[model samples]
Target: MTAVHGDPILTSEEGPIRTTEFESIARAVDRETEGVQVELIGGRLGVKRVPDGDHGRILNWLLLLLMPLNPGLFLHVIGQGLAVGSYRKGRARPDGILAPPDAFAGAGEWASPDAVVMTVEVTSHDSDTNHRDRVEKPIAYARAGIPIYLLIDREAGKVVVHSQPDEDGYQDLHSYAFGRAVSLPEPVGVTFDTESLKDMGD
Candidate 1:
């Protein structure tokens, strides 16, 4: 496949703290906060929105499809932060991470993506979704060498499957409209039935 193009570069926001410091702060915030989730992306601090009911419904919809098809893989939620981006400088908590059961055993807050096959992101009804989910996340996950990145875009009402990761970015990008059957690529192959999501994500 031709290289996917036009993905904006993931740039830092000139943080006063380094990635190491952000880890400490991120943990403290996660401990203190109730609903929100914190992340360090592109050398900047970010707040992942508290998922709405529909946001959760989207994930649950995926859970049904993923489990039956891929018995060997498991979906890890519950704030599974990953060491992502170049040199693991970025920390991102994907909505769902696909890996073997107990893959994160004995790991800290931000686990390695070595055994992870795919990272799932469901867009929330928030202003930051564009930058966090659309632009920076694909780059971040790709840089982490994750084989596949599945995006359930609420705003666009589509499902985007990204695969063939390299240092620069994902080499293949396939997008399907809601209700259309979307086939995710290898390493974590699972075709998606997004029909239930047709009216959700509003």
Candidate 2:
């Protein structure tokens, strides 16, 4: 079996185990293993496959678009984690994140959501991955006071922009199909062209 990040590696003969604390996840991140991503969800460690080729392409496109538009802000891709909610109850590793350059200055392995201007997630092959990005993560990001959350649903071939977050979930949500243009609100003031985004298999 191939080794996936965040999942337990059987270093000893004791077999597989899951990390249950935020510190453990942080320590794993400090190790800096390649092709591995770790997220702390509801205080439990979760491992996921690194972003595939299509995911990387979309992220790069967004990075390029954002750099010219928001020259002062920083753009972070996969492997950068954000500490969400109070006391780091949840940690989210987004496909891409836009924030101030000093956001995590002198900070630890993860950054607080307060520092994030916007976050993006591209759906993976797993249904749970889809649900996390579409359902759970939005609520988490909202609760953490993140202003914008962009979910690229490869399975649905649509991009959903969520904003105006309150105590509940985002109050505003606009979705556009693969070929349409989606408007991103202020702070990240720009309209995104989803026409070039590749579908799941293509």
Top candidate when judged by TM-score against the true structure: 1
RMSD of 1: 6.7
TM-score of candidate 1 relative to the true fold: 0.90
lDDT of 2 by residue, 67-157 (tens): 8877888778746777774344677788888888777777766667777889888887653575467776888788788899988888888
Candidate 1 lDDT by residue in tens digits, 1-202: 1111212223356456578887887677667756667777777667766788888887877776788899999888777889999888899999999999889999988899999999999997666778888888888899999999999998888889999998878989999999999897788766767788888856
Error of 2 at 190 (Å): 1.2
Number of clashes recorded per candidate:
0, 0
The list of candidate 2 runs beyond 4 A from truth reads: 1-20, 29-34, 199-201
CA lDDT scores, all candidates in order: 0.81, 0.71
Stretch of 10 with least lDDT, candidate 1: 1-10
When summed lDDT is taken over every stretch of 10 residues in candidate 2, the lowest stretch is 9-18
TM-score of every model? 0.90, 0.81
Residue-pair clashes, model 2: 0
